[model samples]
Target chain A: MSILAVGTVAFDSIETPFGTAPRVLGGSASYLTLAARYFCPDVRLVGVVGRDFPDDYVQRFRDSGIDLRGLETDESGDTFHWKGRYHYDLNERDTLDTQLNVLVDFEPTLPEDYRSSQIVCLGNLDPAVQRHVLDQVDDPEYVLCDTMNYWIEHTPDSLRETLQRVDCLVINDSEARELANEPNLVQAADIIRDMGPETLIIKKGEHGALLFNGDTVFSAPAYPLEAIEDPTGAGDTFAGGLAGHLAQVGRYGADDLRRGIIYGSAMASFVVERFGPERLYHLNRELIVERARAFRELAAIPKLAPLQAA
Target chain B: MSILAVGTVAFDSIETPFGTAPRVLGGSASYLTLAARYFCPDVRLVGVVGRDFPDDYVQRFRDSGIDLRGLETDESGDTFHWKGRYHYDLNERDTLDTQLNVLVDFEPTLPEDYRSSQIVCLGNLDPAVQRHVLDQVDDPEYVLCDTMNYWIEHTPDSLRETLQRVDCLVINDSEARELANEPNLVQAADIIRDMGPETLIIKKGEHGALLFNGDTVFSAPAYPLEAIEDPTGAGDTFAGGLAGHLAQVGRYGADDLRRGIIYGSAMASFVVERFGPERLYHLNRELIVERARAFRELAAIPKLAPLQAA
Candidate 1:
């Protein structure tokens, strides 16, 4: 099983309360494929970069053993660049600028080899592009898709159309509320599953993520981090790790999905420790497993005994 | 083991997005002892009420087998009255009015029999009053204390003094931050424990509670509810249920604390289902147990197997 991740591969200028990272290696597909490579080796990347794309970063992807057959070099312009600033609490961020340079005109055409991938990760992108990628794929066993508030507001119909094609949809709490137009999360989950996606993950950042699968809701514990330098691609990293884990295990059963969310949380926890994807690029299996164990411990309790009435 | 709970027994007028419950039975001790009585029969209440205090409410406590020997009828004025309104999300509330009435000058006096009670729950009150109650207790084994932003701001010195005597502290996330003067909750727990209680439970309302016991932190799951009429006595009810569970088990170990938090959460979830303490007053052992089980399932993941390094 392999993952086909399609999204932006671009540069980000991020500013948080801690400091700033100017022109750092970032983007949805960059973080997704990089984090996914740790769990699944056959992770394929389909994204458009530009002439200004760093060679060292490209070498970094190859070093991680990511198949970049569909990584297009749109020499017409520089890569998609995003600038954002995070508040003091790090729970909210304000996008300062977005220059969708090459991303604006580039049409995604998946390489022939990537079409047969078993797992497909539709990173945060235009819903139409997401549909286009899905159209090219043969028959994905599991399709994990993500969308942001941008597409949810601007292109509701296209987003709803894409939602119907995916097995799982990963989004944050606000996006879930906004898309469903429901204040209560449990009700929102119900309304969202009606639109499509048998599985929905509402990421709450520090509050952890909620996985609404079928009629069951699993509350994955958030790793308590003391310092978060930059939260540039934590959500995408979370999706990547989840998709990668499912790919490696070759199963997406109830318990398997739960474990995948934990792995995703573990990956997200690591990515936020430093700027860009520095921590993701350095993590080993030992560290990942350890962090996952810590997460399990965070929410563990002995099986409860029924209390007798007084 | 019996619980000696010291707090208010007053009237509450609540306004929510759903509807209004005007001047209903409320106060910390009313909610606490009502929830606690399900777990332990030997519960004592120590609060002052006035002439206008309803006889039906007094009868309600009597029917539940709560020892009211420590409950004083001051008769100087009416009971403390609080008027508040909840936001649409039911997360934050603004205090519309607070009429201390007889409660302004009332002094709590624990009965001789109550002084020997095994457990003590100091509900949200004046820090000095909390300390005064502590002084009357005869070497209680485990003391659980709750406070709010009002005391944390107005009586920091008194609150700090009271903190040193309690075995566990139960407060919400924001109060914990304000009390510790630290934004990060994990770090806040460390700082708070240094000030007093060895165990700290930080309630996040809809997001659930976090129990920091020694080195282990347990993340308790929130029960999702479609409707929340009022959230006035939720924190007090939580503390009561926890203390009552600890008393019933005759233990306050790590697992005990973990289970106590679950039971506390179950009680809290029920209280908010109706106006004021209406739901809390009507809950039985079976309903409490069922909700606790639901909470467990919310955060339950299969005990994970260590994954092999890829």
Candidate 2:
């Protein structure tokens, strides 16, 4: 099963309390595709980069087994560049600058082969573009879409149209609350589910994430780290891991979703341990398995005999 | 095995976004003892109340199977009274009033029978009082102490001394950070564990809790609720349920502690569903078991074979 990821492929300058990193390889598609490669070998990336994009970085993605058939190089413009600074608590950060150079007039045109991808991950991008990609895919088994407050508030009609087509929608807690206009997350999930997608994942940064599928709900815990070097692209990475696992398993059962969420959480955990995608560069199957096992242990509760009714 | 709880027995006036309750039956010991009774039948309550306290409320404790031999009535002053107002988000609250009436001259004197209790729960109170209860109890198998930020700031010496004697300590995340002077929770847990208790549970309000025992860490998710009526005494109730479950199980294994935390979380969840202790009044073993099972479902993850080393 192949997983298609469509989003930004750009450069990021990140500053955290611990340290700072100059123009590093970043972007939604970059993180998502790299994380997805851990679970499934067939990960196809679709995004645009400028001439400024390094050849070594491009080689890194190719080395990780990500298909770049749909990736475009716009020699006429600069790549998307974002500068961000994190506060004392890494949960919140401010975007210092966002130069949408190549992304300004971006249009995603799925490659002929990518039209039959088993799973499609639409990263945080213009909802119109997400819908365009959706139009191209040939009945994807799973369509997982990620968005932010920007589209939800400014272009809700376009976002809602995208939501109606996707199988799952992933967003942070605040964005979930805003999108549904409900403060309570459970109720927010209910409202959002009613809007379109049957599955909704409300990510709560350090708190973890909640997966809502109709009447069923699953709670996943964040990997507790002593220090979080950088939190950029964690959410996108989580979405990729989740969709990738589902693609590999080729099922949508409750058990498979639960395992997917655990794997996704583990991938995101590894991403935040270092600046940008450096940690993911060193991530291996053994470390991922170990972390997933830790998650199992962390949440494991012994079965207690059913209590007699009082 | 028996469990002993020592803390305030007073009245609370609470205002939330949903509703308001005036001078209801509220206190640390009241909630702790009530929640504990659900797990351990022999729950000993030690606290001081004023003559103004209602006999009906006192009878409620007696009817709930809480041994009140250590409770005192200070006719000279009024009962401890707390008035609080919760913000829209229910996570933060403002203390409008704190009339430490009977609590001002309070001193916990455990009864002869309670001295032999297998577990002791020292609720949020002066560290000196918690230390006094520990001094009186006969070498109990477990001593679980709960504290707040006020004591951490005003009486560091006393709090430290109390921490040195307890087997386990339960406090919220902020207090843990402040007490350890470490902003990071994992680091904070490490620093606090070195101070005394081998086991530490850092409660993160709605985000849930973290259980740290040596190198082992267990994360518990707070039951997600669409409506929260009142949050008073949630932490104390959690402590009571946790210690009480341990007492009933008569063991301190990792499995037992994990079950205890889940039960504690469930009890706290039920408490916030309604104002004061009204919800707990109707809480039965069936409901507790059902909620615990729900928690199991909410966090349940399938075990996957370890991935091959890359």
- Prediction 1 TM-score vs. true: 0.97
lDDT of 2 by residue, A266-296 (tens): 9999899899988877788888888888899
Task: Go through the candidates in order and give each one's DockQ.
Answer: 0.66, 0.56
**Alpha-carbon RMSD of each model:** 1.5, 1.8
| lDDT (10s digit) by residue, model 1, range A1-310 | 7899999998999999889999999989999999999999799999999889989999999999999998999988998999999986777889899999999886798889887989999999999999999999999999999999999999999999999999999999889989999878988999999999999999988888898997789998888777778888999999988998898889998889999999999999999999999998788998898999898888886778888768
Give the count of colliding residue pairs in each prediction.
Answer: 0, 0
TM-score of chain B of 2: 0.97
Error of 1 at B227 (Å): 2.9
**Which runs in model 1 stand beyond 4 Å of their true positions?**
none
lDDT of each: 0.89, 0.88
C-alpha lDDT of residue A116 in model 1: 94
